[model samples]
Target: MQSSSKLFPVALISAELRGDLTEDVYLLKPNNSPDPSVELALTRLGRAGHDGARGVPVVLLHGSFANRRVWYTTGGQGLGAWLARAGFDVWLAEMRGHGLSPRNRLYRDNRVADYARYDLPAIAAFVGEQCAAPAHWLGHAQGGLVLAAALGGGYLAAAQLASLTLCGSQISRLHGVLELPPLIWAARLLLRRREQVVAGWVGPGEGYEEEPAGMVRENLRWFGRFGEGRQDWAAGLVEVTIPVLALAGAADRSAPPAACRQLLERFGSPLREYLCLGRAEGFAEDYGRAAMLLGGNAHNEVWPLLEYWLRHQRLPERR
Candidate 1:
């Protein structure tokens, strides 16, 4: 069995007000095992007095091979900073393998699902505990996939969220066919020569600077066994009726236009809304289509649309 904990230097921004933002690095340690020594430097943001609201909070999760910085560069200060200016607290999460998140030790047996289990759940719990109100959940790409897994596994319930938004998410394995074959080949080659695969992905000598060895191993494992488990989880998309919004970029190769359509069709929420940028919306003129899909550009393009939806949303009575 393995346990994970958050470790990092904490800096206080305000002494009297007790207002601060802390950088948390995480590590997964197996029972009785020597500490792995490497850790993922997970970054999170906290703000107070946002948007006329005293403490509304929103948690943003970044995608694969990316750190939370994408939200700043591509997602633009317009989104996160705007929310903060509007009186909402905002937090961003960097997954284990990317960005500031590093590993606890040099080990070669980690998998992506390890993140699905450890990193994601921990972040969700932390948000639930720390926020003044149930936070709004937003995920992009692989982040979206992780959130879907958490929701399907009963890790996120309506009580834990103000709303759930999936941007460029792949809700069904039916859409993963594009990468299945190559992923299988990669797994086979890794099985035959694990060191070579790890070296290629994790690189050489730059051990401490490289991603967690365990995360590299785990990603391989998840990609190899792809659709074997969780048909029920895939089917459970229909049950996510909590004022959901599904956004897609018209030009996304990973989660193509067809896949986006299928996801919206499968989801059973009456209040659900779908926005396809670069199609009939003429969103391509303002923002590059690719940028729209990769970040929150699509969401920003349709901010007015979301606002209307939000106004109509009948939030459950708070407990």
Candidate 2:
């Protein structure tokens, strides 16, 4: 399944070396959306002068309220860099209205449906076109949710997508006062009035990006419905047979371990695996949502597992 948008005006905006890694940034115009102003920014990482002749292509997607920087910080190495150095064609995607991707004409009106149904599939097609091979996908938090929706919604197909990896994303686990109908109504009302959710309003850190109220509201709707409005998210995922690896933070209150397990159970893929990080699971300490991908511990302990998983996927022949 291809994206509804047309691709054009693709450009490589910058290229620089970071500690033996070559980072190149590209901009892609889908040429169609509710808003014509939106464009996607993809960052490519590889060794200097290295061609695609010997590597599997991998796409790294960041969570909500974040940008492409989630994959790597300036002058610093992250998972994408590690994967590149490990011989994978790594592409980091910045979602619409986040990071290098500018807000579109209907920015506030955008929904996860738009992301799953249009943006990601389009980006995948573009990456495949450039690499001449299907791409392995790794998504964190909200990025994972969008990936699930895309595959389950039929906007993305196994033909062009080799495998999937999700970190800190789950469809259920909303509880207590957060699930009260009146509370949901009040939250939606408040979100509709606010232009955006500010950074630092979320976690106790420096990385969260500002997000449109519509995005928050749409998420709230899912939380309230406990599913994607009319679709059975669990059932949809059950139909997908791609290999999947779901990593969860044991101490993640945002998306608890049990909830993440629920997500894992819903996948019909016979090759699916779920790993929860915590001391009980043989790790030094329990990890939280952000810690799943960030921090020194993640780099030292978690990154290798991811590397091993990606290494198992062979590059697909160009169709």
Candidate 3:
């Protein structure tokens, strides 16, 4: 399959630290398919009126069961826009199934691991090719896992990435949470009626839809099971050495503070930082009202802090 392109008006925001900001939509071709069509969807947000010498490029990766839009709607403050205004090029990625990508009808082949093998590596390589300078990687939830796996596998070259940041993510199998009895029932029902579940989850939207057959089956194969606690691929996180920042939500039942800490602890980086935001942080309160981090409320509260860290690293002499 050949790649296709479409443009959309992504929400943009300006930040206090940088000059101007703007966001754009993008579609990336998949690398592995025999006929490999556009395998990824993304949004590119850039800082206005700044040369590449001003700062490093930043790539934002969204979590599981979510597309790039989640970051924008949730409280990201259009993180891409803010980062761009802050003088950093920003890119937000949508893994195959969640948003603006093609839909998958096959259930037997879906598994979450495909993200690491296909999506994450593809995004990293794409950024390396597009950006004039090394970029920093920011990921939330499963997005973090994909990054870790990519780094572990050597898909993310050190020369191409300045650092890695994870929000509401963990590397320990013990950190996972499932909705329990209800989730179990839901999974069983989904197994029997995958199409209905896919349709319900992927409501009509400008850039949101179902994933492809092989990719969806692969995601389900790994992440399909439901229960109180389940884990896979957490062991790969320990291999990353890039500077890391791990952020968590105090009220997030899915990825609790304790688990997030446990996950961050596995990272051996000397520059690692960890933060946890309370409900009072109002990260999600403004979700859907304005573009925050990427469209995510959690990411919005965390973006400024991340920008501060990135800025400091980029301009150590200022400190």
Q: How much lDDT does each candidate structure score?
A: 0.51, 0.79, 0.56
Residue-level lDDT of model 1, residues 118-216, one tens digit each, is 556656565665556787777776677777666655545656777767667664432233346676455555554442233234222211223444444
Single out the weakest 10-residue window by summed lDDT for candidate 2.
310-319
Count the clashes in each prediction.
Answer: 24, 0, 44
Quote model 1's TM-score: 0.67
Q: Estimate each model's TM-score.
A: 0.67, 0.90, 0.68
Residue-wise lDDT of candidate 2 within 52-167, one digit each (tens)? 45388999999878887788877567788778888889999998888888787777777788887778877887887777678889998888888888887777887787789989
Show the colliding residue pairs in model 2: none
lDDT of 3 by residue, 13-128 (tens): 22233234444555666545333443466666665555444457788887655676655543435555567667777777777656665544333344445566566766766666
Higher-scoring candidate on TM-score, 1 or 2: 2
| Candidate 2 segments whose C-alpha is farther than 4 A from its true place | 1-7, 52-54, 175-177, 202-207, 224-229, 313-319
> Which ranges of candidate 3 are over 4 A from the true structure?
1-22, 48-54, 73-77, 104-108, 171-193, 196-233, 279-301, 313-319
Off by over 4 Å in 1: 1-53, 74-78, 106-112, 171-183, 186-231, 264-268, 285-290, 293-319
- Candidate with best TM-score: 2
